[model samples]
Structures are given as structure tokens and as C-alpha cells.
Target chain A: MSQTMPDWSVLAATCPSRTSLARIANKWTAMAVSVLGGGRTRFGDLKARLDGISGKVLTETLRDLERDGLVTRHVFAEVPPRVEYELTELGFTLHEPLLALCRWAEEHIAEVLVNRESYDAR
Target chain B: MSQTMPDWSVLAATCPSRTSLARIANKWTAMAVSVLGGGRTRFGDLKARLDGISGKVLTETLRDLERDGLVTRHVFAEVPPRVEYELTELGFTLHEPLLALCRWAEEHIAEVLVNRESYDAR
Candidate 1:
């Protein structure tokens, strides 16, 4: 478990939010969160949505999301057992910003590509 | 030097933007960019704006910013030598989103603090 430091500094410090930022900026996390934005989803469903993510990394990301309070995980007691994850209100709040980033990446991708060619040619 | 793969995959990959996201999400980067939003600034000026950053880390961060093209560095021929950094248009474009994150952090910081306490107690 990570140490729980005082609240004031966590908000003030960049290191603390580095983890959160990493989570949001992660390819899998962003895609997972975006897919979850549709509604609640099971682990397998999420795995299907994001192709090529190792099971280990996916599990780790999910745990981080739960720990950070961005997503809620509910486990059911049954024969096959069921687990579901969904975004909290706070998580939902992050959607617009994350979406904005995705939109920016999509829109400026061509420009960024052009810049890369010029940047590399030099 | 980090490997420069094809341009398309970079925009598509999470790992690539992880560096850029990490750069923007960094406490110092946010603060530095915010300060630079005022206009061009000297290296020492940026160091002053962000407290507690070591010179090495600051230099590294500046290099990263320049490499990513978020900042432009100008060196002057003089007795003492003068260097300045200012944001590019793309860097300026990133300002609003970064500011939004800072504003969100400031506003919800109290709520996040409360959540932390409750979360720890459990």
C-alpha cells in the first residue's frame, strides 16, 4: 500500500497527481474509462474493448482506478461470480477533459505528424 | 535518445503521450507554463516561480519541454549569457486545458481531502 501523506501537500504536489495523471493518460485507462462511460461493464467486456493489453496491466490499472476512487468495483457472490466496474461521479467529471484530449490528439494528429517529419529531417 | 517510431503510432499509443502527459501533469510544468503564459521568461525566473525544484531537475524538465516543442529556447551572445524560454502556439493552446486542471484541483481539493480521510479510515 502507498503511504497516505497529509492532504494539503498531495493537492499541492505534482508527484502525487503524477499517478492520477498517469492513470488518466494511460492508453488502456483512457480507453477503459471511455468505454465504461457507456455504463457498467464486466472485466471480460473491458478486456475486449481494449485490444492487446496484457491481463496483468489491465488488472493493475483497474485496481489503481478503484484505489483512486475513479471507479467503483462490485463483486457478486455466485456460482461463476460476477464483478462489475463503473465510474464514480468524480470519474464521470473527468470525461470531458479526457475526451478533449482525445479530440485534440485526433484533430492535430496530422499536424503533429507533419511536425515530426520536419523535426526528424533536421 | 528515445527511439522515434513512425508518427502515427505515437499519437495512437498511450506510452508516447505518457511523456507529454507527464510533462503537462507535472506540478512544475503546470506552474512553469502558467508563469510563461504571461510571456517570455528567463531560466532563473522559471526557477523562482517553482519552489523546491533542484537545478538538475529543472534543467532536465526544460530540455524535455524544448524537445517536445512546447517551448522555444533563445540564447543570446553576451558577457554573462542570456537564455529565455517562451511557449509556442501549440504550447499556448495547451494552456487552457492545463489551467482547467489546476482550477479543478483547487476547487475539488477539499472534497478529495475529505475522501482521502474517509478512505484511509476504512
Candidate 2:
């Protein structure tokens, strides 16, 4: 029998969904997902594409995504081992909303900058 | 005369838009925007509705949103005083995406939790 799911609201401090919102709303996570949306990527490639991300933070972010089932990691054995990360099916569902936020930031940065300058002048 | 806008990509290390993304993608900012989406709200009401947010953090979050032009703060001169916040047109545009993310988190928390448990078990 199907059970009724608990109503979840991120606004509620005690809701478990708050944790999920925190994870997905993260800056690094947003950037990482944006990059990964291109296709499967290697660790170094992801690090490079993400600009200023540190190797440690990238590792942590990917591990967290993996734990959350939003990303999958693959390790290949070779003369030198290789690893790749790709978004899972569930992650693909999240890509659009996440990418839209990134695009919004890019599109509105000019307006936001002007607002910041004016606010600081006051 | 109109000028061509420079390409702004969040994936770029030096892009200004990354700062905007960081602000909007913030946990408190997400929750604050979600609450303010209901319409104008008083400071006390906002604090109460957002659950465990500290007064200082809410103040800072509101100030940041105000600076970014995503929210407006109003002060009324009266008996004691009245202060309220409401989203600007730009903020209203952002509300849909931010709320979608929050709803996504709420909708997916169960799957994420199950993934965490199984991943931790392995």
C-alpha cells in the first residue's frame, strides 16, 4: 500500500527538506551542476570549468551530490586510473531549475550592480 | 546610444554574476524570498515565519536583498514604528524560480534521505 508522504516545507526550521534546500541552493553546487549539465566530466575538467573552485571543495561537493543521489561517480582501472562524474536521472530533473537560477544571476547582474552602488551611496 | 553588454558567465572565475548567484542561491535568502513572496510582511512576522533564523541574520539577508534590488524595505513613522518588506518587480520575477527550488527540495527530500541512508550503509 502507498503511504501518504509527510508535508515538507523548507520554511519550517525543523523540516528535513531544509537540508536538501541548503544543499541544492549552495553556490558551489549550483556552479558544479551547471558544468555537469554539459555531459559526463572528469574531476580535473570539472575543476577547471568551475573557475575558482578548490580541489577539496569540488571533491566534497561531488561526494555530497553523490550521497544525495544527484550524481554518480565512476572509477576505471587503467595504467592510470580515471574517474568521471555524471548526473543521475533524478539529477537531470533538477538541472533545469538550477540552471535557470544561474542564468537569472547572469542576466540581472548589471541591474543588481547598479542597485548595490546606489544602496551603498545612501 | 546603446552599448553591447559584455558576456557574463557564472562559470568564469572573474565574472561578476557569480556574486549575484551566490547571493540568490543562499539558504537564508531563499527562505526570505519565499516568505516575502506572500506580499508585504513585518519584521517580527518574517522572523517568526522563517522559524529559527536569528534577528541579525534576517537583518543582513534583508539588507542584501534590498541592495540587490530584489526586495524593498519600508519604514513608517507612527506610535512606535512600523517596518515592512516587499519584493520589487525584479524580485517578483525571481520568486518563481526560488520558490520552485524550495518546492523541489520539499518534494525530493524523501528520495534524498533514502539515498543517504543506502549510501551510508554501503
Candidate 3:
């Protein structure tokens, strides 16, 4: 049987929770949220911050975040129709855990690379 | 300009860290770590435990985790040869954060689904 401790589980065959997992954990989502963790910004500005993201992808990721209720989208009815995206209180919860993984990636990347080489050599 | 605050930045184009991000944030990696977070097990057991994973996919994920130094594989050269997998200290670090995400997935999946339906209908 799958080892499911009381408080958590991803072991079921047909759990909606597994579907939810796909929502929060993605490269674009992680990057976008990390950038947004500091604060909210406009779509164009947020796109600039994330380096290699395409405009299309940035829109999709933001849409996903908004759908998940982790982000809020505000449209200011002005000359250019100003819009801004910010994390909701729910979205803010992701900051520390996501940062932990990012920090892990940054700090232990060399070790991972060396291990990768070793595995490849084998 | 990209809003790169002092400490963290997924904001740079030519960063090796960008490469590192891909390594850590994969669907399979997250699943495997969550399952293995409980304890070690044999290949058959783990595969059986995870509900919907193909054997080939599980092997690849475990190999990736091992290469990243988060998992250790042991082979006992007995009559038939037994294999086991266990988490390293680094892997243990993932338990809490990973659990947090899993819990969030469980608790908020209904809301996420509602949001998805709303987004899709638009």
C-alpha cells in the first residue's frame, strides 16, 4: 500500500488533489510567483522581470494563478486601461516554500551537476 | 528594467541558476519526493504505492532524485539481489515544504476547480 501518513497524501489513483498539484508547481508559476512575491506589478512589467518568458506564456501563467485564487487581477479603467496583478493572501503563502526550493537549487546546483555527470558516466 | 530586489531573482537571462530551476521543478520529481517523504521502500513497493506511475517513469524520477543527491539507492547482493531507496538529509528537507504544497492541494482543490470552470467559461 502507499505510505500515506495522516496529514497528507498524493498516493491515490484518481484524486482531484493530484490535479491541484499541477496548478501550483510549474516553472512559469514558480518564477512568476517568486517575482510577484516582492509585490504586484503590471503585465508588461512582470513579463520583463521573468527574463525568458514569452508574452503568451506569461499571460497563461497569470491566468492560472488567478484561477487558483492565488492572484488577483485589477483593471483600472483609464486611458490605456491600466491593469495590475498581485498575489492574494493565499498566493503569499507560497513565497517561503517556493523560496526554499529556489534556494536549494541555487545552493546545491554544483552538487547536483556533479552527481548528474557521475550518473551520466555510468 | 526587471525588478530584482536584493536577495532573490529569477530575473536574469544568462544565469546558471535558471538552468537549476528546471531541475528541481518537475511534476514527477515532486510526486516521487512526496511518496518517498514517508520512508524508504523497494522498487516494487514504491511503484505499487504511487497509483498511476509507469515503471519506466518511476525509474527515471528516482534516478533524477539520486543524481540530485536527494535519494540513495542500495543494492543487497543476496541470492536474488534486493534494491531499496531512501531519502537523504536533503531529501528530508523537502518533506515539510512538499507536504505543505500537498496539503494546500487537498484543501484548496475545490476552490481551484471552481476557478478553472469560471475561467474556462469566459
How far out, in Å, is residue B93 in model 2?
A: 0.9
Clashes of 3: 0
Q: What ranges in model 3 sit over 4 Å off?
A: A1-9, B1-9, B78-81
Clashing residue pairs found in predicted model 3: none
Docking quality band of candidate 2, CAPRI definitions: high
Q: DockQ of each model against the real complex?
A: 0.16, 0.90, 0.49
DockQ category of candidate 3: acceptable
Report lDDT (Cα) of residue B18, candidate 3.
58
CA lDDT of each candidate? 0.66, 0.93, 0.76
**What TM-score does each of the candidates earn?**
0.72, 0.96, 0.83
lDDT of 2 at A85: 99
Fnat, model 1, is 0.01
Q: Write the per-residue lDDT of candidate 3 for residues A46-121, one digit (tens) a residue.
A: 9888887899988988887888788999999998888899998888888777766677666666666687788778
Ranking of models by DockQ: 2, 3, 1
Model 1 regions more than 4 Å off? A1-31, A48-52, B1-29
Candidate 1 lDDT tens digits, B1-122: 89764443222335344334445546566667767788999988778766566789888877766666778889999869999999989878777765565555554555554665666678
DockQ of candidate 2 compared with the true complex: 0.90
lDDT of 2: 0.93
